[model samples]
Target: MSQRQRLWQRLTEAGIAPGCHQALLDTGRLQPNTLKLSHWVQAETALWLDGQLLPSVPPRRYWAYHKPVGIDCNVRPDDPQSIAALLQQLPPGVFAVGRLDKDSCGLLLLSNDGPFAQRLLHPTQQHQKTYRVDVDKTVTETMLQQLRLGMRYQAGASWIEARPCLATLSAPNQLELTLTEGKNRQIRYMCKQLGLKVTLLQRTHIGQLYLPALSAGQLLELQPQQVILAAQQP
Candidate 1:
């Protein structure tokens, strides 16, 4: 068979989830759709989610946004301060790839592809996301080491351990950390556990997709390949 097809066969046989590759295909990173089976997997409806043909799916789109603090990442209609409202306008079905709590801000990716979102946000992917944080107390190497070694915290009714991540001190009160998975308000909670108060929490990168110098509340439309492929990278 084709080299690409053979590669897929080998990857699957090697125990990697085929869903990961298919998600990339559905996201449009596998361009020209050589397999022609791409996108069809998740399509609904003239929609040949490759060959089915009922109703065609909408063209995929991605965005890099610098969310200002206080703006919720949710899309609840009643929540006027949600990111959707902040955009003033947006195409149908567009949403944040992952959430950044209202109290935090930074590089947030938005997209219309569900599979892409699921794949990127899935904790198993362990895609590196970087953040810059400011705290109330002076930073220390000990704190950085502790953060890098991981933390155990409540998960539902049980306690669970977090995956280790990379951390470094940038200033007396500032830290740069890279995490593969994100729990809700994890940085803030973890810092509090270490006797520090988080003052600023800003995401600066998602995989290889770094935030351009956009001021808070600004965004730029882009192709999924520009960033979707990044989550698949080292």
Candidate 2:
């Protein structure tokens, strides 16, 4: 095996998937982006196969999971219910992109490919993630308008922009909010700033990936088209 293939084998053993390696290579190519047949893994493929290398995955795989409220996004080597524990039986190397606190539930994306995961999680991509929040108090039109207008907040002696939250569902005491920035406990913090409390939180979408009809704790592999669309962004 070539040195590159040898390194790739080690990566797989270390829980990195092949598709991610392909993504890195794709990113390094010049314009008129075209992947040659040699890009495909072959028994005789050399380390210098492309004359240039990148950390990537060929056809990145994406998964949509219905995460339950009780499970943490992290793997607990000891907890069988953690996302990692659950994936152990299906395949190796899959990992969650962004995180959802243990108390929140809804759609989540996972992949064995590292480059794809990096793009989705990177701050520059600005991929919008939406959530459905149920709060303890009724919302006022003025409050909704404020949320929509980007409220100001104090973050330890510094001011920060609070992006507008688009409401998708509403009840006297419950609401679904769409957010762009994935700040830690941002929805809860925003509601608290407005004198409201969150009774429940669920993230329903990530870019074009939706929670769909999957019940909590179930996972579905993303279709090829879905992956392409997600990468392009709307």
Candidate 3:
């Protein structure tokens, strides 16, 4: 194994959230004076924080869950209908990377590694999210072109353009759309603006990771590499 890597990179690779690691260093708990960014992480090297030797990073966990409708992505302990309440078996520390509204259902990635989540969800990354949508009426070519080119929406005091990388009529009343941005209910909003009613909105892919053949409300643990690889795909 290559033994040369920056401290932050090592921490991220070890499944430590970059922000969390920096917090410890900033608080004088990580002994920044003794450690340098150029320091290498080795099997025999010990990491100390707050005078206590830190253990090797815990094994990273990743899961692809088929979020069922009615399950809120950001689950609060007080919300009985949240994903946390519906799926009580998720390992502690794991959280949904992004969100699926209470009415939408499909693939949702969960992970304990904050850096990994950041990489996938950061707006700058522009990871693609694909959805299969069913509308109340037949979608026209003009509407598809409008979606592909872009559409404007009111944002408080301003208007913002929302565009899809790919939009096609999967069926007379169904559409397959891929987007790189995550705005608030973007797909639904886009459809509403186009004078269409969305009857069903299901996310089928996030980057290259697809919703496996799992039943609604089901969870499947995946190797961390699977997600990383998917995000790297075109």
Candidate 4:
């Protein structure tokens, strides 16, 4: 989408009240700023609104949130457990990265920076996400090897396509599984395919970033610089 198109869609989604959008176009309210200068527009452009200039995108923010079970990943205003309400004290447009299912819980990265998220999430990056899972059946060597072999399983209409992960017996009926892919409930689907029912699932790591001393619903901001530096170290 062009810078102009993106701005129009943003305003439309924000629910322009008692006004025609043509007024915005005619009145010079759409400020493209540096959006025209680059293919990636970060911290550069936003629609000028009201009587004054709406601020350009805020400085990027990154937070590692310990998301609890039952919270939806999206920022649905009506859902109490929506991430928007969960992180309401934070600035707007901050959204969760590395989504966890409503039943899954653990280290969910939240950031206002889209490019940074894309850097980590694009399938080719192969960033590792570690999950601790409790299962109803024994976690055996056979199961581990199958997952290591990247067993292809069909989950309903979609395929659970993931890179082979190292699955080890962490404890009886439990496994520590790490994957470079973040498919929806991929671990649970893997467990089910192996005849194990997932009793609990929690992500503990994303790349080099980890949750530290955070309780459920707690948000701890990280210095974006340090996070990138940490990823480069070792």
lDDT tens digits, residues 61-154, model 1?
A: 7888999998998766568787758543766556678899999989998766666676788777888889999999998788787888998765
Alpha-carbon lDDT of model 1: 0.71
TM-score-sorted candidate list, best first: 4, 3, 1, 2
Q: Local error of candidate 2 at 62, Å?
A: 2.0
Q: Which is the better candidate, 3 or 4, if ranked by TM-score?
A: 4
lDDT, model 2:
0.68
Alpha-carbon error at 11 in model 4, in Å? 8.6
Write down the lDDT that model 4 would get. Answer: 0.70
Say which prediction, candidate 2 or candidate 3, comes out ahead on TM-score: 3
Q: In model 2, how large is the Cα lDDT of residue 165?
A: 64
List the candidate 1 regions with Cα displacement exceeding 4 Å.
Answer: 1-55, 86-88, 154-160, 223-225
**Which wins on TM-score, candidate 2 or candidate 4?**
4
TM-score to native of every candidate shown: 0.74, 0.71, 0.76, 0.79
lDDT of candidates 1 onward, in order: 0.71, 0.68, 0.77, 0.70
Give the runs in model 4 whose Cα sits over 4 Å from its true position.
1-39, 42-52, 224-226, 229-234
Residue range 74-93, candidate 4, lDDT tens digits: 76777887876865666665
Q: After the best TM-score superposition of candidate 1, give how far the Cα of residue 48 lies from its true spot, in angstroms.
A: 14
Shift of residue 76 alpha carbon in model 1, Å? 1.5
Q: Which stretches of candidate 3 lie over 4 Å from their true place?
A: 1-56, 86-88, 155-158
